[model samples]
Target: MLPGHADFALPAPAAPVRLNGRRPIPEVPQMNGHSEAPSANEVPPANEAPQPTRSEKPAEPIDVWDQRVAGALAFLRRRLAGNYEVDDFGFDPELTDALFHPMLRVLYRDWFRTEVFGVEHVPVDGGALIVGNHSGTLALDALMLSTAIRDQTRAERHLRLLGADLVFRMPFVSELARKSGATVACNPDAERLMSQGELVGVFPEGFKGIGKPFADRYKLQRFGRGGFVSAALRTGTPIVPVAIVGAEEIYPILADIKPLARLLGVPYFPITPTFPWLGPLGLVPLPSKWLMRFCPPIPTAHLTEHADDPMVVYNLADQVRETIQATLLELLEKRPDPFGL
Candidate 1:
């Protein structure tokens, strides 16, 4: 202090110490407009609170394989413990939900962009018959309908499909179909399923509906012998007529190859625009907009032995067909285009 000058003689200020290992802030001196080097002794007020800086964190990625593995393990555990549920017809509920349904949902919800209407019309409890238009060269309509019932309804009903003889004729496919809740199409099976208070799904149009040329799309084919109607009546189950649109366009059958079909020993060899020409790629379905509407339940409790009468069954079947046909026409009018709607 004495070395500088007599005017500079004064006690020096105490040095500031760091807090929480942080260096003390410095105040710069003014030179020109900007301040010069700051003093190291400039400390903040002790009474003030320190503010924390805001930081954003990136989201962690999801491991799809992990989820799939975990789900598989869980499914395995359920099966080993005899916790899995399957009907008398070998309809493995656990297997269908845990495995097959996920793959089919990709087609139902994502590819087709399916929209379900009048899901409320399907009974949540007791036995009921679901009759819908069947089409699409691959019978994808049935799968889509099954998905709708499984996903939309509160009860999450499993649709017991009545498959044709050809469906069970395939080796591995027959086993797969049975596990997916499908049984042979017959009066005895339908009656038995309904008696157990199960929801039965029937495609009355049979091969005609699915194998028919795309030009006949949305046209109601003849309901076979009203046998499904008789089944519903026998079990005193209500009939739920469902109208399906957009299945016809998935694979447009331009023509039928009679010679090839006869050789194949199949119902009909469909000549769709892309099939056989595109090879395996032709099997891919067009992402057509799908619309499924469920009409109100037509109660059969009022009708007596009338269900046994051929004429009564015919009239009832016609009524159901007409109703579905009218509804389909209305729905078509509402839809502007097949792909977009």
Candidate 2:
């Protein structure tokens, strides 16, 4: 209110304070039929209502299921009101959380009995590349990994998965995948997402890893051409080596129908113990205990632009694969049975 303008006004008077800035101490309710006397400086206003303390919680206990249902409803309302948030790649965050994430949560908890380690390695913010060995006759492992990120990470970060071209070419599957926060598995898409600070997930093993027979269960297939590495290098994203155990046992692909695949114009048609023989009923994934271990991130942001060079990418990809393989072996040692612990 000094030398600015004629409209400048004097500062408003401060709000009145009680008892010269000291609040009267509250009464101590008697526990043994004895009320304590007040001190000279302390005076309790008999009519003044007690205010809840900063550390105080409600007297009534909160129901856990109620809170979760309320949250989900609120989220759904926001989405219904067209206040939904989605990324450029068509990742509908609110819908995914309210709808699909719950389904995945059940599978992660009840079906898989999943245990996670090295969660601290995942950056609470910013972009990261999570590379894992893929399997399960289906890409159920990918969904499980996504569930792991949602469960393990403090931020409950959305993992923008890079999937094969075939994924985007399907009908309902394509739309579902896009809405579930997946995009084409290519260098450009991965780079763009990382640059925008998304946690990108890649299974370089592609269909090969998932299609491999039950005999080759945990043995990770080749990580293919190091394209994921190149994307990571170009975007300078930290690459987290994620090793998943127990996905291999889910469907347990026993044999493959090559003729059926050719007729369907698709990849190998898996014939699991229950699948084909059991028809659609086999689609239900077997309950298997799962472990997802995240090793320390291999930093690539500091590397020179040449990090995208084939040789550099090849080397980095090899390093990440070795790290995942070693961690997988260790997780296997720790896990006794696919269904137990």
- Computed on alpha carbons, the lDDT of every model, listed in order, comes to 0.79, 0.80
* lDDT value, candidate 1, whole model: 0.79
Estimate, for each residue in 1-341, the C-alpha lDDT of model 1 and write its tens digit.
55756462111222222221122122212342222223222322222333221111123224444676898888788888999767789999878987889898888867877766677789999999999888988889998889888876769899999999999999988999899999999999999999899999999999989988877888988998999998888778999988888898999988989898889888888877788899999999998877777888889977747879999899889878887887788567645588873
RMSD of each candidate relative to the true structure:
25.9, 18.3
Candidate 2, run of 10 with poorest lDDT:
12-21
**Model 2 Cα displacement at 96 (Å)?**
0.8
Shift in Å, residue 24, candidate 1:
61
User: Candidate 2, 273: how far from true, in Å?
Assistant: 0.7
- 65-93: candidate 2 lDDT, tens digit per residue: 47778987887687778887676889988
